[model samples]
Target: MKIVIAEKPSVGRELAKVFGATTRKDGYIEGKGYSFTWAFGHLLQLAPPQDYGFIGWRKQHLPMLPQKFKLAVRKIKTKDGFVEDPAVRKQLDTIKKLFDEATEIIVATDAGREGELIFRYIYYYLKCKKPFKRLWISSQTDEAIKDGFRNLKPGTDYDTLFNSAHCRSESDWLVGMNATQALSISAGNRTVLSLGRVQTPTLAMICARFLEIKNFVPQTYYQISILLSKDEQVFKAISTANYKEKEEAEKLFVLVEDVASGFPAGGNITAVEAKPRKEPPPLLHDLSSLQQEANKKKGYTADQTLSILQNLYESKLVSYPRTGSRYIGDDIFAGVPDLIAKFTGHPDFGKQAQFLQTVALNKRSVNAKKVTDHHAILPTGEQAYGLSADKQAVYDMVVGRMIEAFHQECLKELTKITIQSGVTFVANGTVIRSAGWRAVFNDPEDDKKDEDNAALPKIAVGEQLPITEKSLLEKQTKPKPMYNEASLLKALETCGKEIEDEELRYAMKDSGLGTPATRASIIETLITREYITREKRNLVPTNKGLAVYEVVKDKKIAQAELTGQWEKRLEEIRSGSSVKDFKSEITEYTKTITHELLIAGASISGKLEEEKKAEKVEQ
Candidate 1:
């Protein structure tokens, strides 16, 4: 019998149903000469240090770099401690039995780096030598699955992809295991001061921003404010320049441009510059962009958004959720019109969808070259039903974004009115000449100018207008706002852009602190380790986090450039570069960081104690 394996049970059942497989057995479904099985996400993980004879957290086991990594059944936390999950071990045995009995194996796991690793780990752990073909499909819809099976590629074609994933897993283990043990041992073993390659740098960013905001000194500044009228339409304007001293602003504030100052029609329209701009529709929603938008619009955390989108994906309502690309290839773009038509009945987006049918679809998001492991997330044109409120909200976003991406460009007229009052003042306004994509949601503009006038009355240069009011507006310089989920995700995507080393920056331009699939977990990990906390919408570092950041802020492990270097090497490995060289370098760095943390972590013990005591007091 041919055997197929999927990443989850739901997906496995869906695939089996598509193949007319309905005979359910202990751990699989069988029919039509195929047996469909699955792993619950990851069935195995790298064995812990103690499993390798590094018994306890001690200096002697500071850098416990295993000569060869071993995979153990995934574990769970029981009241006693973490142990091999009995169910997972049973599933592994079931899979081993199926692999032994199978004539040919079909790998139906998710199509991405992590998915590749999951299947490879299972296959190698089972010691199965059966040749397999890969079923790579972005969406789990029946048609996509059927097409994917018809064109299964040789498993060897993804050997290098597996190599890249293996390197990543082993490197993470080497770094995370060694660093975590080293720091935990040195800090009096009071509490687990967990650390990882991505988690540390993320924590450092939070701490650094917190300190910056805490130390910022605000300076009070003043600007001249005036109200001008043209044809019975009143608009507000502000001085073009700010003054440090109120006395200087007061001098300009009383220049007698108001009616009270006996200066009617004192405002002269020096220049009225109105320029038209064409704003193309935003690209389709990649995971990162969708998460950011959800955070801003619905106040959903990254993890929450990922979970909801995953549900939508499993239901076959949308495409893959973890994709990094925001562009669809032309092959997929060919069905764009039909997909848009599927949503012509959507309550919120129907009008826009109806209008889109008559126009040439925008080609901004259609680029086969930019499509990576999978295309950007898109609706499968499958009708959705009985969706929960959260799921429905996310589903609507996917549909709405699809409409916006293929709609016409928004034509806007930007007007800047330079008026000569007592001091030079300016009024800015934006008029949407054509709503275009904006009509999909009809949401307010996100990039509204500061002190912008909603609508400016028509006026010509060299025309005089009455000054309605004047005053000296006091303002204080503000520090950068704390990082919220939306801004934080955007920052994580471009973290390497500010690197002083041009080569490293260039290397990391395509990657950031973590992949789209892993970034949500990174934030959740920091919170799990007590390194950060959520204050309403803001992610703030705790005292414990600040303490750890102080110790490792200067270390290479807490630098984005380290991840950059690793990413550059990993991509090379994916392209058939030697993995041995990369592994050797990682081993050396692991030893170095383990030794440094053994010494540097001692400094944070007192601070951790202080925090513990503070927590006790609060309790």
Candidate 2:
């Protein structure tokens, strides 16, 4: 008999069904030759400082770098102290019993970094030596499940992935634990000052944005607008030059109105340039893209988006929700037609699906090398009618993207017409020659991105139109908008670089501050630590958050480059690069950072002393 373990009960039951384990038993199901059990996510975690007898946090015991890291059962904080969760302990006992009785074990957790860590930790905790095989699948579809079983990989195949995950966890512990204690002691306050490798840089982005907006002084500028009409079609155009003073623009505005009063054959059109443009359908939605879209369209937070996507995945209506790749491998591409066929006449997407079936698939989204552990988030070919409104919305978004991915590019004509009035004023517009994928949404009103997307009436070179109205328009140079979850996600995706080289940037995107699966929680951690707060859709730094930023602003921890380099090295570790190089670097940096923070505390104290003397002298 073999034992199977999964990340959660919801997943365990799916694996159980595939293995013919029909007998429902205590804390697990068993039948035939298999026993399927689950962990409640993480049953084991790193031992805390107190676990090693370093109970109280003394300044002398600041940097606690253990020679051998220890593991303990996951515990929860109670009124008195931390204790093991009974449910977790009980489940572990059941799994241990199965391992003792089984001929071999099967590890069937989610195929990702954290999932790898979860299973490995449980094996070590239970002290099991049973040979195990790994079941790796991205979707819960019956076909995907059966296929994964037929192709079980060796448990050792992913050892490097485990190494990478383990390194990430331990490094966070070493730096975060030591720096947090050092800073707290230096501040000389009971308030626990939290610091993280990723979260600190993320917080710095928000605080810096807030400072920029807070200190901005708006500058007024002036321009001229001319309302021109040709063949009963009217459109607005702006001046080619800007006037620093309103009076200067007013004079030009008056002259333009005088010309319009006479309706002089529309200030002779000097040039008309028209070019065809194409907007290819957007790529498939990875987790970050879905979260950004949800934040922009439905005002959902990153955590809310992940939760909804996770629910959809568990319900078997969608694939995995935590994927980072937006492209699918050829293996998965062969099955896309079947998934799309399920929606043929899907009351909501039926018409679009029917049309997509006839279009040639653009292989830009079918590169196997671009796919990582999982493909892009996609539908499971399962019925999706019973979901709640929020779930339905997310499901529709995923399904709609699939429909768009296979359709033809939208065709449009971009026209730039220059009118000669001593100074050239230009009018720009785009006319959709063919809707293509845009037909999927069937909402022309919503398709318009700006005035640029509006249709332009037909006109040729040297063509003249009547100027019906003209005036001066006053506008202020606006500051950059506040940081919202959508924009922040984009910034994080690019590793906070204002990069235009797509290939270079895409290569470095993996070096972002946090993993897609963990970025939401990192943000929530900052909020829980009172470093930042949400004001409607915008993220605003609190006073305490700003002070923390100030102390670490000049330090390495608050810099994205430092965090990004660590992230890059972690990826190298995933590909079998040595862990010793990274480990050595982080340990040395930790000591230097601890010392700097202590000195920062002293510097702050000196500044306070000077302020006190200034106050006394004034008095």
**Per-residue C-alpha lDDT of model 2 across residues 236-298, encoded as one tens digit per residue:** 777889889988887777666334467566566888889998877777888988898889889
TM-score against native, each model: 0.96, 0.94
What are the lDDT figures for the candidates, one per model?
0.89, 0.82
lDDT against true structure, model 1: 0.89
Task: Give candidate 1's error at residue 428 in angstroms.
Answer: 1.0
Over all chains combined, what TM-score does candidate 2 have? 0.94
| Residue 322 alpha-carbon offset, candidate 1, angstroms | 0.6
lDDT of 2 at 90: 91
Q: So what's the TM-score on candidate 1?
A: 0.96
Clashing pairs in model 2?
266-465
In model 1, the clashing pairs are none
lDDT of 1 by residue, 1-619 (tens): 9999999899899999999999999889999999999999999888888889999888897798888889998999999999889999999999999999999899998898899999999999998888999998989889989999999999998999899989988998998988988888888898888888778888888888889999999999998888888778889988999999988888888884788888878999999999999988988988988999899989999999999999899888899999988889999999999999988898899889999999999998898887878899999999999998889888999999999999999999999999997689999988999999999999779789778988899999999888888877899999988998887887677662444332343234355777788899999999998899999999999999999999899887898767756866886788899999999999999998898899899999999989889999999
